[model samples]
Target chain A: MIRWLLLLMLAAGPALAVGDPADQLPNPAQEERARVIGRELRCMVCQNQSIEDSDADLARDLRRIVREQVAQGKPDEAVLTFVHERYGDFVLLKPPFKMATALLWGMPAIALLGGALLIRGMRRRQRVAPGPQELTQAERDRLAQLSGRPRE
Target chain B: MSEAAPNPEAAAWRRRALLLAPLAAAGLGGAGFYAMLRGLGTGDYDPRGVPSALIGKAPPDFSLPPLEGTGLPGLSAADLRTGKPMLVNFFASWCVPCVIEHPQLMRLAREGVAIMGIAYKDKPVDSLGFLKQRGTPYARLGVDQPGRVAIDWGLYGVPETYLLDKGGIIRWRMAGPVTEEILAQQVTPLLRRYA
Candidate 1:
């Protein structure tokens, strides 16, 4: 009986999370598309979570807007642009490549190139003087002379 | 790719530079952080401030019904483009920040500034009671019961204020309570610049 109760709870849990069934599109394909778009939108309230993942009221409203746009047969870009026009680039989880975002987009490539150069420099450094060379016989004799110790 | 052995002086210089790199970086970062903290203390920096996209653009189309029992006229987007700059404020009965901002709004209205109010996501009865208690400063009022109109305006939080130019373009926006200092420093300057 307890197992049955637990199973019942597990089934009901996701239904509650799906939230306000009226917001979902009737077409399954459209619903999936709406969800994909939702994942790209930032929740303005939470500042971190995507509208798809956040339970904030603003997130819900954005999700509903995405679904409505999808149901209207709007392309993904058009729907995204509709939101972008209203909320600006901050709403996009992946910021668009523009003069304003050039630095943000270029940083990973810059870091990668820096890392490659660093590794090559280290490799060249390692190869040039393959670690500390064994002291020459003259150097060893000189070291012994300086320290006043007999060479073994 | 020099075949000769590395110069000892050059290698030593590189080693010294590598050692000092982190210290220099830390010093620069610490100075920047200290400046940011000082700005925060002086109310010059707002870490959570999000620049509003609606600035320099007209507001989204909306026409909200007035709250019942208020006897105030409803507000709409058409009412905004009347060749007069005005303030649009979204507040709620339950928002404590709205209460704090109310006095400034009242002061502005006393000086004959056209102020429009939207009761955001609050019940009509609660809004009416709130207005009754505080005395409405609004020249025109609307109730956004379902908050759809708020979403159209890209409103994420309540107690937000917008200043519109004579052309009905949004000139400035303040997201939190409009305290006395903010009224004197920022909003007053923005109003003149747009005017």
Candidate 2:
């Protein structure tokens, strides 16, 4: 049981150390706010990862900035706007809906609608397709003659 | 009784029309793929080329102390409004690209361009040593020990250089090392234009 407990603790080790950087503010509430904000801000160094999730030096700097802003009593929107103004729209993990990002945000839905239309068109075509017609006596006779066989 | 079958040509046309569904889908898919590739090629997909929001805006004011005992003057935002365009270079002793660009900075300094340096997130002693070894190319050198001033400048990383006009508005920013080709083609033209 002790060995199993030790293994569990070891498994949780990295998770505990993940976002607990030395730069975290001493105020727990402020730190929490910073974390919330940081989670929404992309790490400029690691584009796909949020600053809260990235361990890159740049990310740490960003996190510190966020914490400092929060500690200074800045509102969340103001803090976000500050970084956005400096880094452009790329620093936000969730890009705002705008003219430039319309295609990025709408492409999946557009593709889905296109796919649905295609499938519906295919199904409708299949439904409207004419069934195989029974061979007429004359066509049967012609086939028999061509094949050199006796007609039924 | 004789019966006629459907017209062969009309049926062929209908079949061809039915093929349009998949063809349109294939076209849409191809377009999406092409867009994704283009986005990856030129858009914010590459963060290095991400545009600085400070391009047209005046830089925030800052006053940083010179590196301890270097005898260099400290840099301030007010110094940039000297009625002549200048360059502000952010570098660190540890950054390899900064070493690569040091000689170019020296050449620019030699050409009478007033350049200010920020030793970003570096120790004062290391910065002093670096300037001593590589030769000083800056009119003023400031040490950003905790990097608060750097964050205020929205610096992405070390080895970033910004060209400010006489009014202290940032005109152009280069993110990485200053190669000779870049200096000639990009920097020199801008300097001449601003001059």
Candidate 3:
């Protein structure tokens, strides 16, 4: 019975530790908005983690700022722009399409098209008749000389 | 010869194109790979520095209390527009780099540069104690407890210094500890330019 109780407690432990207590807001609606925004903002310090997932001090501060802005009735884009203006494009998990990032976004499609064209060309080349196994002028001349015939 | 002999010039051109096409693609691919490697190697190039969006913009207003027992007046954004260039430094007792940067601040203070210090995220008592031992270089010191002021200033971390022109527009920002070299080379020249 004690072993079963211990197993049950272990199973429940993960559920208790799932959500971050620091991210809670006074209003549930505002908290949900903050959560959505936080997921979109990258933690500048941690680089790899979103502000929602990072436990870095700067991330916590940013989360508070987001919650405060949301509580103040700022829209989602306004809140994102606030952080974006300060940190540049790097703070956004999804970088906006702009002149600077045009090449970055276009490279994959260009590579794909280029690959397709290359494959098509290769297939076309294979379908072409292995054009006349004709001898070169030197080879013909040598052949004629070796066969004891007059040069043509 | 076969039923139809291929045009020799055209065949030669086709052969050259076939040979050059993959070579050109490989060259491009290699260049792209090299660029990617260089980008990755220089990732987090300015890890300590985040360029402030507030540059050329007026600083946000604030009325922070002074650090206790420092005998220095509290600072406001309006005070920065004194018709002369000034430096605003964000620091804290808890920050190790702030301690390292203290001497450079002292030298600037001694040279008659007007510097305003914001004690970020530190207790008044601790900040006062730290200044007392290390010597306060600020003409005016403000205590930013919750760091709302620092946030408005677009601060990423402690030990960031901003050079503001006479009109209170931020001209330049230096993140991380101010070494003697940076103080001499970048800071002094900009200060003179604005002056």
The best candidate in terms of DockQ: 1
Q: TM-score (chain B) for model 2?
A: 0.77
Which DockQ values do the candidates obtain, in the order shown? 0.37, 0.35, 0.24
CA shift of B125, model 3, Å: 1.3
Candidate 3 to truth, TM:
0.74
Task: In model 1, state the lDDT of residue A127.
Answer: 73
TM-score preference between candidates 1 and 2, better one? 1
Ranked by DockQ, the better of candidates 2 and 3 is 2
DockQ of 1: 0.37
- Show where candidate 1 strays beyond 4 Å: A1-18, A123-152, B1-23, B41-43
Model 1 chain B worst lDDT run, 10 consecutive residues: B1-10
What's the residue-level lDDT of A116 in candidate 1? 100
Write one digit per residue (lDDT tens) for candidate 2, span B43-115: 3143357778789889888999988777888998888888888999999999999999999999999999999
List lDDT for all candidates, in order.
0.87, 0.86, 0.85
Task: Point out the worst 10-residue segment of candidate 2 chain A by lDDT.
Answer: A13-22
Best by TM-score: 1
Q: Report, to 2 decimal places, the DockQ of model 2.
A: 0.35
- Per-residue CA lDDT of candidate 3, range B127-191, in tens? 98899999999999999988888877777788899999877789988778887767887889999
- Point out where model 2 deviates above 4 Å: A1-22, A133-152, B1-47, B68-70
